[model samples]
Target: MKILVTGCAGFIGFHLSKHLLEENNNVIGVDNINNYYDPNLKEKRLNILKKNKKFKFYKFDICNEDKIIKVFKKRIDCVIHLAAQAGVRYSLENPDAYFQSNLKGFYNILINSKRFKIKHLIFASTSSVYGNQKVMPIDEKSDITNPIQFYAATKTSNELMASSFSQLYQMKISALRFFTVYGPWGRPDMALFKFTNNILRKKQIDIYNFGKHKRDFTYIDDCVNAIKLIIHAKKKRKKFEVFNIANGKSEKLEKYIKIIERELKLKAKKKYLPLQKGDIQTTSANINKIKKFVKYKPSVNIETGIKKFIEWYKFYYYKNGK
Candidate 1:
């Protein structure tokens, strides 16, 4: 299969692209390598992917319609769109970036995907779209009318747009609502990385929502595998489908921090703070829908996941006291 993967340099994109390449699939990669966190990390992930002979890369933003069209011209069979401005708090500071990348950027990908008749278009959505649900184990049928964050709002918009496009063009589109995914080469902006970095440096790690927030933290490998299965799902799926790709378990914020501390063998100086704007107290996903569709089950537990991340983090950033 010839697959076009946007944001190939990103945390999830890098892992997914590597997985696809290992499966002997021809992967055409695209990423703007924006400095949302650090372009250096993105570069590192991209460099690894470039080592694969079956992988081809294009350095450009998905918002560039003309250039994106050129990539689709490569006789691409499918697309895995993971490129987007991703962050809840960052959305509060710079909403324009989110609009440009998540809104306009995804719009370009969606339209061009239809024009080229790409099969099995799988894109990354987020569990944030469910907002602060009163129900436990938030499912695909939850009411997502009220997204507290602009990032979630944009992702929710993406799902609606996908639903419309799939129905209109009879396009086979699947949106995976990812939970709090963490692993080696994970985004530095995310919780696990930030906590690990700060703890090792003996810096105070801020615990949000007064250390009471719960999140369904999914491992990178499991998340990527669920995507791989969906890409080649043997069953006929609905034109537009949504799945919650998660660990099927929720861990509290403080509990998550303790895991990091245990793995690092060091205590972290913590400061409890009220939930910031666009922050939710809890995010739990009902992954049964995805399990039914693709037999998707997240295998990595948080204990081992954090240990793996700590090893990678120490090797990458916690060395030489730099």
Candidate 2:
């Protein structure tokens, strides 16, 4: 399959692109490589992908309609749209970035996918859209009307837009609502990376929501595998659907930190802090809907996931002398 993957340098994008390439698929990857966290990390991921002969890359933002249209000119079998301004707290500081990238950029991808007559358009949404629902283990039918964070609001908007496009133009689209994903080459802004880095450096790691928050922390490999399965799953007769690509288990923030400490074999200086704005108390996914659709089941546990991440973190940082 010839697949076009946006944000190929991103944490999930990098892993997804690599998986597809390894499966002998022709992949065209695009990313602006913005410095949301560090462009160096993005470059490192891109470099690895570039090593594969079947992989092609473009360093353009998805908001660039002309460039995106040019890429769509190729016979693309599917498009995995993972590019977006992602972060809850960062949304509080810079809402426009979210509007431009998550909203406007997504608009470009949707229209172009239709124009190209792509068979499947798989896009990344977030569990954050659940918006602190009173219910446990959020399903696709959960309330999406109230997104506490602008980041979640934009993602929710993408879901609506994708559904409308699918119904209007008979486009096949799947939105995967990813839970808290972590693993090697993960984003620096994510909690696991931050905690690991601080712990290794013997610095104080901030525990948010007073260390009471619970999260469905999905491993990178598990999340990528779910995506791969969905790409090849029996297509639903419907033009649109959403699935929760998560671990199907929630772990406490306090316990999460302890696991990291144990893996690092070092205690972290913890600083407890109240929940910041746009933070949810808990996020757990009802992945039965996904399982039914694609036979998806998360295989990596948190303990193993953290150990792999720690090994990568130490090797990468120590090699770089950071």
Candidate 3:
């Protein structure tokens, strides 16, 4: 299968592209390579992907409708649209960036996908869409109308746009509600990466919400594998469907920190603080829907996941002098 992956240099995108390429699929990768966090990390991810002769990457923004349409004309089989402005807190700082990429850029991809008669268009969503619901486990059917954060609102809008496209044109589309994804080659903006970096350097790590937050963390490998399974699922295609790609184990922030400490064998100097605005206190996923659809099983526990990340972080920075 020929797969088109947007945000190919991103954390999840890079891993997914690698997985798809390993499965013998010709991958067409695209990224603007913006400096949201650090382009160095994004560049490193791309460098790894470039080793594969089957991986074809174009350095361009997904917002460029002309260029995007050109790529769509390349007889693409499926589009795993992962390019968008991510980060919940960052959305608060720069709302315009979110609108341009998440809304405008997504529309570009959607229209092109529809115009090209693409087989499937699977885009990324967030568990943050389920906002501060007074519920335990969030499902596909949960109320996403009340997104606490601007970032979540953009993703919720994406789901709605995809739903309309799927219904109107009978386009095959899936929205993946990814929980707190973390692991090797993780985003430096993410909490795990920041925590690990601070702890290793003997700096005091800030704990938000007084370390009371709970998150359904998803390992990078498991997240990539689940996506691969869904893409290859032989089930009758639905016009629109949503899946929860999560470990389904909502662990507290304190416990998560403990695991990091254990893995690094270094005590973290902690600075507890109130939760920032646009932050979810807790997130848990109800994955029965995804499980029934693709037999999705998240194998890595948080402990092992953090360990793998720390190992990669050490090697990536220390050995490579990154």
For candidate 1, write residues 1-322 as lDDT tens digits. 9999999999999999999999999999999999888898898899999999999999998889999989999999989999999988999999999999999999999999899999888999999998999999999999989999999999999999999999999999999999989999988888898888888888999987789999999999999999999999889768899999999999887888888898888999989898888898898888999888888878899999999998887887667453
Model 2 deviation from the true structure expressed as Cα RMSD, one decimal place: 0.8
Each prediction's whole-model lDDT (CA): 0.92, 0.92, 0.93
Arranged by lDDT with the best first, the candidates are: 3, 2, 1
Model 3 CA deviation exceeding 4 Å by range: 320-322
| Candidate 3, residue 309: lDDT | 92
Task: Give the 10-residue window scoring lowest on summed lDDT in candidate 3.
Answer: 313-322
User: Judged by lDDT against the true structure, how good is candidate 1?
Assistant: 0.92
Between candidates 1 and 3, name the one with more favorable lDDT: 3
RMSD per prediction, one decimal? 0.9, 0.8, 0.9
Candidate 2 lDDT by residue in tens digits, 187-230: 88999989988887888999877899999999999999999998
In lDDT terms, how accurate is model 3? 0.93
